[model samples]
Target: MKSEFQSHEPDEPFLSRVQRVLTDLSPAERRLGEFLLDFPGELGSYDAQELARLCDVSKATVSRFIRRIGFESYDKAKKAVRDERATGSRAFFAHAEPEANAAALALDMREEKDNLDRTFGKLNAGELDDLARAVLSSRKVWIAGQRISFSFAHYLFWQLTKIVPEVVVFPQGGETLGEHVARIQKGDLVIAIMLRRRVAGTKRLLDAILEAGAELALISDESMARHADARWHFHCHTHSDGPQFNHAAVLALCHQIVVRATLQSGREGRERLRAVDAVNEKLLQVEW
Candidate 1:
């Protein structure tokens, strides 16, 4: 049928490909495409017959839509969408309409649950162990995150500094980020939290960290998957149930990282914790 989807470059985003074919599709096909376009995540959950019923289109139109999108069959189209979706691509989040009242909370819970499942499912055990080892052995661990992500970075930094010596968080008060980058030694590790609406200059900052001979680690949402330089890349899912984005998955992932690092620290970690407790007691940091 010489559909517009056929002209897409191999690397182009599937969402963009769908958009390109929007005007070329018949009325029924366009309706189905638009529905899937708005609820791209649903593509993973619905079969052709079910989707046809939901979109008020016939089975033939569903089959035609699959081919129009450059897939050989309905199953293949669904698989492609699911694969792209698993990456936590921004397209799925872009058009996810906000809900109201109790529906919003219900949706939030559902989406957050899915986030944890998908994120933990994809995590590699060996890679996690390697990150823990890096934390325990590095001369200094430099952590950086801006905006909302800074909260996660701060929590991780707070936990890590108590267990490991020489942990630094960048842009402390009057100091600049570049100053911190300059302090990174060859054996140091840099953990960066870069989620959606990525901070300007983040890639450049990571580059600077790498150029300074420090190993780079990334804790980010699927949108940042293309970052090839990270020694360890942990991608989390951040789908929100409402108008705002959800961060529960990111927090859970960070918690796991801290737990692993603590376990890897072994006797040294226990000694450090005891020392911290002694100081806390003397300083009356925690009220009884």
Candidate 2:
């Protein structure tokens, strides 16, 4: 007789399969499940014995968990994870235990340095120049980011506005995001900073921007690299050492883009800075 576990949908992701079996899982199985959910790509990196060791379970338990999730064997489950990753799954797995005290401080610095190195190592100069030129020549530029990503949007907007004409960072106090997105017209450029597990409606907003005839540029982390819909997409490294996601690479990219845009704007940028400075001086906005 054929097994019922074989009835699972072939296209379902490993994480989703684990989630489906969550209620039926034992405490040890659930622990393994949670880890796998967070780090599915790691599944491809370890065998049944290694996975069981990492999860603090017996090899038999790992085999059972694999079967429970509809895989006939542990190896088969591992291969599924590998296949999913090749197809662009959101799995940037850093299998590290949480550090504490002095060790945590060192880990933080090391991870941030790694993030910066990896992000810029893969940076494309041609894409950067094209994006900068698009911003410089755009009739209007709109910037938007949700959750913690809003910081990047605000910083880019703050710097770019000083040198570029008609630059806007949207969803300011008393404004709806939809209202701003709706105003995206032809010849406009929209830069959206969407990081891991992007805010709801982000994809829809990108689609809406495109439908409205605006060019969309996505500035996101690797998790969104394969999924984001945009005319131009830039990925920033966001590996973190602590419990929270880091933003160092994203900020660095923002800084680079701002510098590039300023350079592309040339004399217009200098004049804009001078004009803003004169206004600041006249209005006593800065103390001498």
Candidate 3:
């Protein structure tokens, strides 16, 4: 006879399956379920024996728990959890352990360093120059982003304005992006910075950019590396030891791009900087 568990949806997510069986679990199973609820990705991080040790249950109990959740084997369930973790969900970092100590701080630093290493290790200088060239030569350059990416896009826009005169950043607050999209021309360039938890309209925005005959540069996390619509894709590593992503690498890349473009701009960049300085001195009464 088919058990009640056999009626699970074919494509149910790993967490959904666990949540479904959570209420019906035995005491030992409930403990394991609650542990997973804290950090579902931990399922992929350990084996049955190790998980049993962490959750204070027997190996056999671990076996039964996974089976009850609709996975054929521990290996299959682990792979599923690992796949889901690529979403960069906050659940992956949720834990009861205190992070105010030195060890956690050390781990955060190590992860940041690793992210920097991985991000720059694959970076090609020639590719950066190509992007910088596009920024310099385009009739107009648009910097686009939403959610956590908005700050990065704004920073890039402000910095690039020092080197290029026709730089624009978009979609501030309640305004629709249609006004900006309508203005894109053939000689324009669009640089989009979209990190994890990107909004649903992301594709539509990219599509509009391309359809308007503008060149596209995409700066996003590694999960978006496979996105082929953009002319250039700069995939930054944002993995972190804590709940939030470390976007230091993304900031560094933006700085690099602006600096390179400014250096390449020669006398033109210098004049633009002088103009901006003149305005700052005249209006703001600031010394720099």
Candidate 4:
């Protein structure tokens, strides 16, 4: 009988190729792929030792598996996986026609609502209040995110600036991340947003912030929660519409945080609004 686990043909579908390669893999390689397929979110965040421990394999086995998958090292394999996920996510969303994808989007929306409900049920009021107070009192606030997460960070930065004196959104991929992090004082707060597929640069920034002794407010999926050293952490549950792409639930969480912050700032926020209106009124009189 012909082997069912043949090398993938050039024209083969991605999922089919994945399945074929998985079937052809040695037992150890198969275990590793199974681990990745079963918990892509978890595997995305795990180190080699952690992955090996979870998969009940040795570190050498993990290394061998990585090499078998055509990556020279574990880090390279992880990076490949991340890139594949990002590309797959973008492709899925790009191909989706609003009318044709409506049912799928609706399903996603419903799932997001259920996640929000569960999160609210489990949220600690006192912790939220403390986080709000920290935001209100911090001398400076730094918001950082990459890719899809950049939108969430930008939204929070905008809202926080309305009520707070100093707020900055860290730009995407600069050579000066370390220098920027160096400027954070003890009273500063860093709000970092990352999701299932956390960006490497974002993680590096988070680490730098921790070393600088800045307080952290982390908003991420549950799988990435361990990576952040947050004084307060909010886990946004997201379900994958395909093999990749998970952002809707995170955007909802961002909205929730901004709304909560606005409510907590009340009078201060109103006063700032008045100030902004006055500035806008004067600025509107001038034409470009």
Q: Rank the candidates by lDDT, best first.
A: 3, 2, 1, 4
Off by over 4 Å in 4: 1-108, 172-175, 242-246, 285-288
| Candidate 1 stretches greater than 4 Å from native | 1-101
lDDT of 2 by residue, 141-208 (tens): 99988777788899999999998879998778777888898788999999989886666787678778
Q: The CA-based lDDT of model 2 is what?
A: 0.81
Estimate every model's Cα lDDT from 0 to 1.
0.80, 0.81, 0.87, 0.68
Q: Write the per-residue lDDT of candidate 1 for residues 1-288, one digit (tens) a residue.
A: 653445556556667767878888889999988988777766666788877887889999988877777777778767777778655454554333344335665733788888899899999989988998999999989888887777888999999998989997777667778777777879999898998777678778888888999998899887665578788999898876444677888999888889999998999899999999999999999876
Better of 3 and 4 by lDDT: 3
**Candidate 3 residue 256 C-alpha distance from true site, Å:** 0.7
lDDT at 198, model 4: 60
Quick one: ranking by TM-score, best first?
3, 2, 1, 4
| Candidate 3 local lDDT, 1-288, one digit each (tens) | 757554467578888888888998899999999899877867887889988988899999999998999888999999888877777776766544455234456644787788889999999999899999999999999999888999999999989988898988888888788989999989999999999988888888898999999999999998885568788889999987666788989999999999889899989889999998998888987865
Q: Against the true structure, what is each candidate's TM-score?
A: 0.66, 0.67, 0.83, 0.62
Tell me, by TM-score, which candidate is best: 3
Error of 3 at 240 (Å): 3.8
Instruction: List where candidate 2 sits over 4 angstroms from the true fold.
Output: 1-101, 227-229
On the 0 to 100 scale, the lDDT of residue 91 in model 2 is 61
Model 1: lDDT equals 0.80
